[model samples]
Target: MTTLITGATGKTGQRVAHRLQTLDHDVRGVTRHSTPRFDWHDRTTWAGAVDGCESAYLTFQPDLGLPGADEIIGAFAAQAVAAGCTRLVLLSGRGEDGAQRAEQAMTASGAEWTILRSAFFMQNFTEGAFADELAAGSLTMVEHTVAEPFVDADDIAEVAVATLLDKGYVGRVLELTGPQLLTFEEAARAVGGPGVAYLSMPTEDYITVLTEAGLPAADAAGLAYLFEEVLDGRNAYVTQDVETVLGRAARSIDGLAGGEQS
Candidate 1:
């Protein structure tokens, strides 16, 4: 039996698949266009995606906040059950109501579940949303000027891999956060590169910038909602979950921003 990874194209999922493979586990990924196509928007793919799977790393793409995400998750949980998948490691976002809803659905699915609730990823700057802006010498976030302890994608992946491969994580909601919090400017400064400026702007202004950047309106809206509603000091506090799960302190942004001059 294989451990299926959803959203295999994403940063976290990519890391999870690699980690699982490194451990010599039978791992397979679900992608819309892959040999085993796993499109969450297409339920017909779920059965095939979960086929011959004893466990799964479930990461919803676009986001868990999308319309009907909860319903889709619940349905998928049922499919996992029918497919004989006993372990379901769900990737959930901290402070995200939609993720919480999806979590509840997974829990109620009757499978041994592990919810890896994670903080915002630091990869957003290098591999995700802020990558381009960072490259362009401008980075924008919802909060005008507050530090967020962005969790490393590797940390999230390691924790998820552990939960998926080990039984100790069953029924646990491991909330992994970075060791410290830093404002966007602090994070940029920590990048310690030639020069990275972090600016704080109003949520509306941030939304406008995102909209102007060619992101769909809905994505811009959700991002604005995340920044204004969720990231507004709610995630500034650092936690030891990373240390607890990985048996080591979380990696610092400075180390992660490798080769950048402060």
Candidate 2:
């Protein structure tokens, strides 16, 4: 059975594609600019990408919490089902209210659904915004010294591909997280080194740095909003979802960033 994966170039989606292809599955990588072109903003492109596929690994680009994501996800799910897609695995954010709305839309879109709810990814340090900060030897995060159990994209991908390729995982809400919890400073130190320090800057300072670095005003504002809104001491817990799914505990944040062992 062929499976189409949206956002196939992203941190988690790329791993999912690798896992699927390694197993020799007829994996289809869908993007906004593929030969058939599958832009999230265009409902017309999804039909071509999802055509004749029995399953789809749906991961919205930018983010599912972005404006009007629900409408777009709902429309795409409907089209996929109409085009004969049977199962859908939705990658959703953990504890974001908007994400729940989008997940419900997919659930009601006439396709069997499995939602993988995940907290902040550990890859943010090695591959994203935190990368520069780690390299700079300082990380000024707005989190209030709270612990967060970050999940690895590879682990999340393994579970997603398993659910997509192997059956019997329908209607499950797998909340993926790391095996241990680490505060923002601790998390930062793990990636960089003992020289790294986490500074709790004021919201205004945070906005200033983000803006000074040439980030758009809207994106800079959104970055502050994430630390202030979604990460207000609420995402500090460990879970066994990864172990349960992959038959082993999720990798730790420090281990992920640690240099190769001698």
Given candidate 2, what's the lDDT at residue 223?
Answer: 59
Question: Which lDDT tens digits does candidate 2 get at residues 91-152?
Answer: 99877767788998898898888999987888888787788878889888774756788888
> How many collisions between residues are there in candidate 2?
0
Q: Model-by-model lDDT, in order?
A: 0.81, 0.82
Candidate 2 C-alpha error for residue 210, in Å: 3.5
Q: What lDDT score is found at residue 144 in candidate 1?
A: 49
Lowest summed lDDT window (length 10), candidate 1 = 253-262
Segments of candidate 1 deviating more than 4 angstroms = 192-194, 259-262
Residue 232 lDDT, candidate 2, scale 0-100: 71
Q: Look at candidate 2 and tell me the lDDT of residue 208.
A: 83
lDDT of 2 at 180: 83
Q: Which residues of candidate 2, in runs, are more than 4 Å off?
A: 211-215, 259-262
TM-score for each prediction?
Answer: 0.92, 0.91
Pairs clashing in candidate 2? none
lDDT of 1 by residue, 1-262 (tens): 5999988889898898998888888888878888778888898888888888999999887788655788999989988987799799998887788778989988889999999878778888788878877887866666644467778888898888777777988998888888888777777656536587666678788888888989888878776876676665666688898898778888877767884311
